[model samples]
Target: MPAPTHLLIPYSFRRKGILLGALLGILLTACQPRHEQAAEAATPPVGHYEGSLNAAGQPEVRATLDIRHPSPGHYEAEFTAPGTLSFVADTIVFSNNQLRLIRPARPGQTLALTLEGDFWRGALTLDSTRATTILVKRGVPTPSTYRAEEVPQATGSAWLFTPADTGTPGAALALLPDAETAPTAAIWADALAREGLIVLLLPPTDSATAAAETPRLLAAVRLLRGTAGADTANVGVWATGARAAAVAQLLTTAEAPRVAFLMAHNMAVGPASNAVLRELRRRKLAVLGLYGGTTASQRATALRNALGGRRGGTVLTFRTAGPDLLRPDGGAFGPGLPGAVVEWLQGK
Candidate 1:
C-alpha cells in the first residue's frame, strides 16, 4: 500500500527548496566584483572646480567651474575665466561616467571631461586645437563675513565693514564708487576699516533709480549712527566721478550738517561742481581732492582755483594713478594710494 516515492515528497519541503535556491542566487550576485556593483549606484560629480588655461602666446587665465545636478540626468554648469571670459552652459550632459557642457555660439567650443579620483581631466576644443585642462575638486568659496545689506529706505545696497571691536562711537565713512567699481570699493572699505573707521560702501546705481540717491545716503548715514555706533557728527562722504558730483549736490541740500568731511576724486570743476564746492565751503566742511596728474591735472587745477580762498580744502595730484587706480580685480590699489587715503582720512 506504499505510495510512489515522488508522491511521498511533502509540499512544505518543496517550498523550502525553492526558498533556499533564491537565497543562493542572491548571495552569488552579492559576491560578484565590486566594480560591477558600483556601476549601478554611480552619481554625477557636483561641486566647484578650479583650474587654469594656458594658450600659446597668451597670458595664463584662471578658470573656475561650478556644476550642479538638480535631478536625475539633469545638470547645470557655469564656466568662468576671471578677467577674460565666462559663460553658462545652456545644455549639460552626463552619461557613461563623462560630462559634456555645450552652448550654441560662433567659434564653437566643447568641454569633454571625465572624473579621475579627486580630479577632473578634460580638453577644451576650439577651432582645431585642443587645450589640456585639469580641474581639482574644491569647496565653494565662503562668503565674506563683511557683507552688503539693504538700507531700510534706500535704493541700492551698502556693504558694511565693522571692526572686530568697535568699543566706542567712531567716525563713519560713506564710500560711493563709480557704477562699475564695487570690487574696488570693497578694497577701499577694508583699508579704511584697518584705520579704525566704520566703512559703509554704497555701490553705484542706474539712472532709473537715481532719484533715490539722496534718501538712500541719508538712511545709510543714520544706519551708521544707530546700528554701527558711529558718531553722527563725524560722518564723512567720499565719492568718485559722477558720484562725487552727486554727493556735492547732496551736500547743498538741508542735510549738509550730517557729513563733516568730504573727499572727491576725479571730479571736474564745472558749474555744477563749483556750486557744490561753494555750498560746502559755506558750511565749513573739510574737503580733500585727489586727481591724476596726467589725466585730471586741468580739472584739478580748476578745482584748486575754486577752493583757493576756502579754509579746510586741499587738493593733491598723483602721477600715473588716475581713475583706474582701483585695479580690475579689486584686490589692490595703485601704489601709495592706500597710504595717502589713510593719511588724509586720519588728518595726518
Candidate 2:
C-alpha cells in the first residue's frame, strides 16, 4: 500500500501537535476556574472557626465568629457564633486583626465564647456556654497581615439539614435544593424508600461552607428521619455531590447514625473528606458512586470492577456518563447532571 502523505510528512505532525496544544490550552483555561472554585469551597473562609457544641439553650438560634490579625504584633479579637445564622449577611468574619463572633442569643442559652488566636494556636474558652469553658485547642498557622478587602457573602441555596436521631421521619420530606437549582428529586425520594433506602437530599456545598452549614444540615436530616416507618431498625442516609459534608462529618467521628448506604456523585473528597470516607469504609458502610465528572474513565471502571469482583455488592450508580446539578432553588453546581439520584440509590 502507498504510504499516506500526511503520515510521512513532519509538517503534518507539527500541525496536529499545534492543534492538540491549542485544544489543551483551551481545556486547561476552562477547567482552572472550576477546580479553583472547588479548592476554594474546600477551604473554610479564614476567620470563622467551627466546632460542635452539645449545648444550645434556644431551639432556634444563629452563630457567627470573627477572628482577625491585630496590628501584626499579636493577634486578638472577639465574635459571636450564632445558631441558624443567615448566610447572606452573617458571615464567618475575620478583620481588623480581631477575634469576634456575633450570633443571635437563644432563650435559656446564654452560651458564648471569647476566642484568641496567635501564631501557634487558638484558645476559645466558653465565655457563656456553660458558665465558662474552653473549646478544643487547635494549632493556628502564622497570621497574615491585614488587607482591606470586601469579604464576599456566602452564596447558594444548599441549606443545612441534619436529622434529630436515628429514627424514621414523619410524612414530611426534607428536600435539599442544589445550590444552583432545586432538584425535583423529591419525587424520586418516595421511590427510593421502596428499596429500603431513605434519601437525604443534600445540596452541593464545600468544606468552608459546610463547616457552619453542617450542623443545620444534620438538624434537618434528624428532623426528616423522625418520619420514617415506625418500626424499622435500619435507617439509610444518602447525599450527593459536594453536599456530602455531613456524611463526611459523621464518618470522621463515631457519631454517624446507622447507615446502609452513603451515595455520592463524583466522589470528590479532600484531606478532611478522605478522612471521613476512610472512616465510613472502615465501618463497612457502602460508598456508592454514580456517573460523575472525573474524565479518567478508569476511576469508575475501577470502582465497578472492584465491587463487581466481590461476592455480593450494591451499586450506587448507573451506566450513565455524568451527573447533573439540579437544584431546588434553580442554581447549578459543577459537572454532574441531576438525574434520578434517588432512583439510582434505590437500585431502580
User: lDDT for every model?
Assistant: 0.57, 0.34
lDDT of 1: 0.57
What's the true lDDT of residue 227 in model 2?
34
Query: In model 2, what lDDT does residue 240 have?
Result: 48
How would you encode candidate 1's per-residue C-alpha lDDT over 1-348 as one tens digit per residue?
Answer: 111011101110000000011211211111111111112434557788899866566666777778654443333465655431344443455565677664322125567788887677887765564666788879863222221222211233345555534566667888877764543455566556655677876656664122445765665565567545477778888877777777777777875437788888787688756767887787788888877546667777777777755354888776565464644332235667677877777663
Q: Candidate 1 versus the native: TM-score? A: 0.54
Deviation from truth (RMSD, Å), model 2: 22.6
What ranges in model 1 sit over 4 Å off? 1-156, 208-212, 255-257, 309-312, 327-331
Q: Per-residue CA lDDT of candidate 2, range 192-232, in tens?
A: 33333433443444342445444544444443454334222
Candidate 2's clash total is 75
